[model samples]
Target: MMTSDNERARLLPSAALDVLGNDLLLRCASYLDADGLVQLGRTSARFGIPQAGQERSLANEAARQRFRQSATEDERSRLPKYDGESDVGLPVSLTEGIDLEADWERNINPMFVTSSYKSAVAEQLRSQRTAKWGESNVHCCTYGCKDGRCDWTDWDNETGSFDWQGQEELEVSGTIGLLLDLDEGTLSVFKNGLCLGAMKEGLGGEYCWFVNVGSLCTIGISRGRAPN
Candidate 1:
């Protein structure tokens, strides 16, 4: 039986792989890491677009796993209602695209581009959908650090300096802010209506706002101005 199996394996050619459909291919991709998913998506356009399947895009599915083990079709259809310039605390479930003003401004504060100066940042948002995801996934926290681990700590070593002060932590259910400056190419974070300074920069491309959050976390985003 072993010899027969080996002989059959030798007879099967790489050409047979061409018969494999996107569904099977993507189903197999469920085991890949973020970087691996990104690579697989680039291999073909089908790997990136959403379709009638268990997991739409490989990259999106992998990111969604951080929220739920398996996402239903209803959950994917329910997206944040981005009605220009509103204070809506949208419940987030996946690391997905948020169609904002691309870059909106606020008259209330010169530091922020949103009316929701009170907001929490997450997932180290990239200006591009195909942004390189690494181990430097940024996390936010207002409280609950018992041991040496704090929630508001920045994990990215290349994010310049770790200037996150003790007072920078927000209160329970407090607002956290994130402003993506397209002109200056910087992403600034705010805690309870105060600026935490630019946490990231070098973003000269179009951005799709995304959040990487845990269970039962509600984040709100508000804009005061129109598109640029």
Candidate 2:
């Protein structure tokens, strides 16, 4: 019974390996690391190791196991469950000194003035066919951070500075605002109150807007008809 180690040992001799075919070479390579397999392949032009089958090697499997174990430990040490911009725990007041809890509730504020503000905001959003997410002017949030490197709190906490993969480069002229069209399901960006055309189109379902700004910049969410 030839053990895996013995099979690997048999593959070391360049002269002896010339007689063996590709199938035998792959079987021997299974007990070798990626680099070791490549080295074995170079010994014989006939011993062509398929790139896709490299992971099938036992040594490479061991390497994968070690990497997964380390990644799991790091993932467990995260600070907060990042859902979106709303998860930043920032404070926002709908009116002057009026406290508003961040949660899902329709017609939340019963006060006449607050209700009027909501109505006016919704009306304005409908009239312009544009809506801004969140009630506050400043937002600190990121889109994707699943790799564990782009933690929002890990960077500057105030500005919500974090790395994110975006579809396009947003030309930032000044404090930019993201405006969404509820009817057409399109999204556009406004720089210093100037419309910069539509950024995204065919947006559906409930979507959260996130902004990653520099140290000195500010991100604000204008009041508009809240998506339901």
Candidate 1 lDDT, tens digit per residue, 1-228?
256877778667444656887556647776775556667667655556665754346545544453345445554344322323111112233435433344332212223222123223213333322433323344222222122122332322322223433325444566556676656866666666666566564555433454433335445565321222
lDDT of 2: 0.40
Among these predictions, the greatest TM-score belongs to 1
Each candidate structure's TM-score, on Cα atoms with residue i matched to residue i, is 0.28, 0.24
Model 1 scores a TM of 0.28
Off by over 4 Å in 1: 1-167, 225-228
How badly does each model clash, as a count of residue pairs? Answer: 3, 4
User: Considering only N, C-alpha and C atoms within 3 Å, which residue pairs clash in candidate 2?
Assistant: 30-57, 30-58, 137-220, 138-219
lDDT of each: 0.45, 0.40
The alpha-carbon lDDT assigned to residue 149 of candidate 1 equals: 20
Candidate 2 segments exceeding 4 Å error:
1-173, 216-228
